[model samples]
Each structure stands twice: as C-alpha cells, then as structure tokens.
Target: MTAPEDDAAGALAGTPEEQRAALERWRLVLGEPGQSVLAGGQLSEAGAGRDAALDWLYGRDEDLERRGVRQPRHGGDGPSVVTTVDWLDDITTLFPKETIERLQRDAVERYEIHDVVTDPAVLARIEPNPTLLKAVLRTKHLMNPDVLLLARRIVEAVVRQLVEKLATEVRHAFSGARSRTASRFKVARNFDIRRTLRANLGRYRPEERKVYVETAYFVSRTRRHLDQWQVILLVDQSGSMTGSVIHSAVTAACLWGLPGVKTHLVAFDTAVVDLTADVDDPVELLMKVQLGGGTDIAKAVAYGAGLIEQPRRTILVLISDLYEGGSEHRLVRLVRDIAEQGTKVLCLAALDEDADPAFDRDMGRRLADAGAAVGAMTPGQLAAFVAEQVGR
Candidate 1:
C-alpha cells in the first residue's frame, strides 16, 4: 500500500509517468513535503530551489528528521522571526500575488503571527496588503510600542484607500439631496420659463401660436438646516463582524466631517464603547474596537436611543448580524420604540462589499416586523440610503 500522502496525491508511484503527474499535482497543493517524493532521490539545481521554498511552507519536521537534513540555526534568540522572514521571501517567488496574499492572511489568522507585522525584517521582505493591514487593525491591542508607528502607517494607508473609494460617492449623494431640497419650490415666486417651454413643447398648436404653462416650475430659496441632522451608527464589533466594523469606522469618520451632521458612533460587543470622540480619526477609532466578544444588540440599541434628542431629526443605523446574546424581546422592543419615535431605523446584517451575508435571518425579520428595514447592503447602497434619510 502507498503512503497516505501518495494516496492524497492520487498516484502510487508505480511508474515514471504516474510519478511525474502526481508530483505536479502534489506541488500545486502540498507546497513541499517529503524529499524522496518531490526529488525522486535525484535533486537538481532548479529542483533544489523549489524544494527549499516548498519545505519552508509545507515540509514536515518528522520527514526532515527521517532524512537527517539538519536545519541551520540562525544567530540570536529570534529564530521564529528570522524563520518567518525567510518563509515570506521564499513564498513571493513560489506563489502568485493572489496566492501569496492568501497565504499571508492564513498565517496571520491561524497562527496569530503578530511578529511578522512588527518585525522590520519581515515587513521589509513583503508588501503590506489589505488582508494583513486588516489583521494588524484587528490586533491593535496586542501590538508592541515599537511597531505602533508602522502599524499606524499601515492603518492610515488602508483607511485612505477606503475613504478615497467611498467619500466622493457618499458626498455626492448627500450634496445631490441638498441640491434637490434647495431647489424645492417653497414660495413659487418666479416661473422657470425654460422648463415651462420644454414641458409645453409637445402640446403646441401652430394655428393658435401660444404655449400654456400647464405645470410651471419655480425656483425656491429654501435652505436645509444641517445642524438638525443626527446620524447614530451602532456597530457590532463581534469577531465575525470585522469587515463591517472596518467599514463602519471609516464611514463614521467620513460622516463626522460633513457640515451640519452630528455623527455619533457606538462600537459594541458584550461591552459598548462610544467612539464618537475618535470618529474624526478612523485609525484611532478602529484601534479602540475589541473584535471578539458576545453581542448585545438590545444594550446597544437602548444606548443609541438615549442619544436621540429629537427622533424625527435622527437616523439610527444598527450594523449587526442579529445574533443576539441579550434579551431578544428587549432588542425587538427597543427597535420598535425607536422607530415609533419617528427616527429612521435601519437594521443591517452587514455593511461590507459582500452583500449576501450570513446572518440571523429570523432575527432580521423580527426587527423588520418591529418597523426597522433589515437587510444586507454594500457600503455604497448604505451611503445612498443614508443620504435619502438625511435629505428627508
């Protein structure tokens, strides 16, 4: 019988043709494993480099010990750090950019390799992609003082990217809303002659030679009071909600600077942290969020409800998966009460790029029954929704 690895590779190494075919498939998934299997007991220069890269990623220590291939020891007490840097450097050549990023993300998430982000040597060898940057953001509390600056730079870069992608669209929507409001006919003092002519053009009679103002347009001088607008973002910071949390943080930061907008952000898990003061800086706000914890939707909603001085002027957005750890009845009640107070309430399963989210659909339906509009939405859709509510 063949070894389990060979069985996994789907070839028993009976002939040269079978061996080569299996070897190629194994190399794609297994990275590097046994020397006898990969090299066929005859290693060449190109094969040796491939073996080294594969070994760093997928080689088993037991197989190395069996082969009697003694691993070299680096100088100092930082062997893991040195080994990590070497692994990163090797994988760059061994994998495509997408695969490399996936591997980096896997390593960080599975192993909790915070050292890779902080160690200058590892940082030097690899590019800081969004996955790694998000990991760094998630683990901000675990970061050392020495790496704080580098971490800040990474967070800033990622935040700026998100802001650049989202700011213009959201701002334009808000501005468009304002323009519509500003153009509303409050007094109807002056007729818009051009618009009047365009409207009545199809109904013109050559014999009569006269166009009637059937629906005359008027220029209004009404100005929207921006100061009356209140936006409260209640974000769930549970581990599964990382993507939503990142988006909510950056969004809050963007909305905070809007003229006449009073934006308040609350990040909650089992514990709630009012991040409104830090909303001006998304990096700082994100760093303050503790990602893994039990969720309390009622507590968060109740807190947000207290912040609403005028419910009619407020837009309350609850960003969560609706997996309540607290009293579900209370959560539903609070959502109903808030909406009844005239506040426009939105219950989002998530506010990320992935519109089809895995969440508690039953709970979302419950909230919907209680008067809140519950659904999964991309950030762009959420932005438009916000503009529509605020402009109302």
Candidate 2:
C-alpha cells in the first residue's frame, strides 16, 4: 500500500517477491563488491549460482586491482569453487543461450583461457561462433588429436556460415548489369517489364483496359571478356591481423574457380607461405595458419609479384597492417613498380566484417603514392571491387 524504500541497491517499489528480484539483479550487475551496499547480503540458490558464473569470467579483469577489489579464486582451498567445467555448467543452466556464448567467448578470447576449446567437455558444450572460431584457430595447435577433432566442428560451422553469406555477395557482384540493348535470349530473370510496357504503350486498348503487347524486351547482360585475370591476396598472419586472415581465406574460397578470375591466397609473417593450393578448403588453410610473428610486407609482396603472369591482367591485393619489418624502402619500391606496370594493386589495411583498420598511415600514404589504392574494405566490398575491375 505505502511506497517501499529505495536506495543504491534498487527501487523496491513492487511486491516483496519483485523487490527481492530487483535486489538480486543489482547484486549480479554490481558483482561481489556491492554485497556490502545491498540491504540483504544473502542471495537465493539460483542467484548465487548466477553470481558465481558471472564472477568466473568478469572477476578475472585486472582493473579490479585498481578498484582495490580482490577477485575470489576458484578451485583453491575452497571445497565448492567453480572450475571451467563447473562454470560452463552453471552458466548454461542459469543463463540464456546468448549469455552463455558471451561467457564462453570471454573465457577463450579475453582471459586467454585455452581450456574452453582445448578441453573436450568445454568444447562440446560451447556454441560455435566467429569469435570462438578465431580462438580455435589460434589455439588448435595446443589441442591434442581428440580435442582438435572437436575444434574442427567449430571451424566447419563458422566457415559454412561465412561462405553462405559471402557467396551471395560474390554472386550478386558477378551477376552482371542490365544493358539498354535488347538481348536475343529471353530469360525470365532479365525481363524488363518497364521497358516492354513503354516500348508497346502505343498499342494500349482503352476498352479492354490493357496494353496489347507486341514484343517483349529482354535486358542484355553487359560484362567484360576477361582473359584469366589473377587475384592474388597477400595476407599478413600477425596476431592483430587474425580477423583479416580469416576473412581472406573465406574470400579466396568464395572467389575460387570463377569463370574469369583466378584466386591466389598467400599468408605471411616474417616469411611468405603460398596458401593458394589449399584455398578451396578454408578450414584446412586456417588450421595451418600460425597467427603471431614479425610482419614483412615486402617479402610477401615480392612473392605475390612473382606469381603474376601478365601484369595488366592481374589484381594484387595486399592485406596487412603495413608495419613493414623487412625493408620499408623495398616494399614501397615493389608496390610502385607493380602499380606502374599496369597491375591493379590494392593495399587493404583490413578485410573483415568491420572495415575499421589499424595500420601505418605513413606507409599507407607511400603505397598510395606508388599508385596502389590504400584503404580498408569488408569482404563484400572487396568482391564488388573485384567484379568492377574484371568487368573493366
């Protein structure tokens, strides 16, 4: 009847049950540190399980040290502490599917907890997503034969999703544009209803309230006749470039064996490795990638250059952060030479879903001056660019 008390814990403006629920939500949000501030320090059975699950992941944050809050250690001298398996079980039981995924992702990516994917129990229980897939690629080497088998499921699932999505973009880009000239082939997809109606408008019958159609116009597909134009993707396999590396592999797979284009995938760190042989199987190619090392953009570029048969018919895409470790001068000179020789050079700083790139601006500028287009692009955008270039 009367207004309930409200404080830092939360507003207790409803029934007693609702009031307790509000307090528990606040407790989970504020974490272990807020227990002192809450009116009732005790948590319900479900509430305590949820709290332990949340703490298992977020409590590992080093920033808690600055706040003077010591995180509770699990599996110590305590009898009922949460281990990785226990945390997984607790979160999956107490939280929804989405929350469980976030927790699993945080454990693998944020906390560097390889056990999430390495342990058979945890790997089987976890959901397959892009973040988890990246983690699997990074740590699959650490996994034994049995664990690697489980991790492959994550790779295949994530790669299948990527291929399905990117395949549409590639199909649309290469589908060809409609031309004004009438096509001899009367395909339903290329039917131009607007042009057909306008072309036969003079034959409209007012009494029937319909136009007497004479000839149906079909839109002609206009595409350039390409002579085996090569698309060489030089990807940097540095730790920071993992996203780009993953996307590049998938993109190459999608672009593989297209009528007018030949796809080449090359991954590099300090050394260059031509992955074109395995480009068709992105999952295998990604598994073989070693994600951390010094970057040598020049060495990779030189290797890509050697693969070029006809300079005018090649498109060299260098996917990297542009932090050249080999020779900066040599890198710039190679790019300049390649661009001047009629090769379409595209220096992409990043090639993932998020086009936001972290690259060396000075180096990017020099590459631009060397006649290479320098910028970040999503996989879809890159597909469109390739379509346009090949069409030209």
Question: In terms of TM-score, which candidate is strongest?
Answer: 2
Q: Candidate 2, 100: how far from true, in Å?
A: 2.6
lDDT of 2 by residue, 144-227 (tens): 999999999999999999999999999998988566788889999899999899999999999999998899989788874467
lDDT of each: 0.76, 0.88
Best by lDDT: 2
My TM-score estimates for the predictions, one after another, are: 0.71, 0.82
Clashes of each: 0, 0
Give lDDT tens digits, candidate 1, residues 1-392. Answer: 88755664564546866766566545544443444455554444554555565555444345556675555434676535427887787778866799788778867776566767867667656676778777876776766776766777777788889888889877766664423222445344445667778988988888999876567665543233355678899999888888888889878877776766789999998878899999988887876778887999899999999999888888899999999999999999999999998998998888887776778999989999999988888877877777766655
Off by more than 4 A, model 1: 1-26, 30-55, 58-82, 118-120, 178-227
All candidates: CA RMSD (Å): 9.8, 6.7
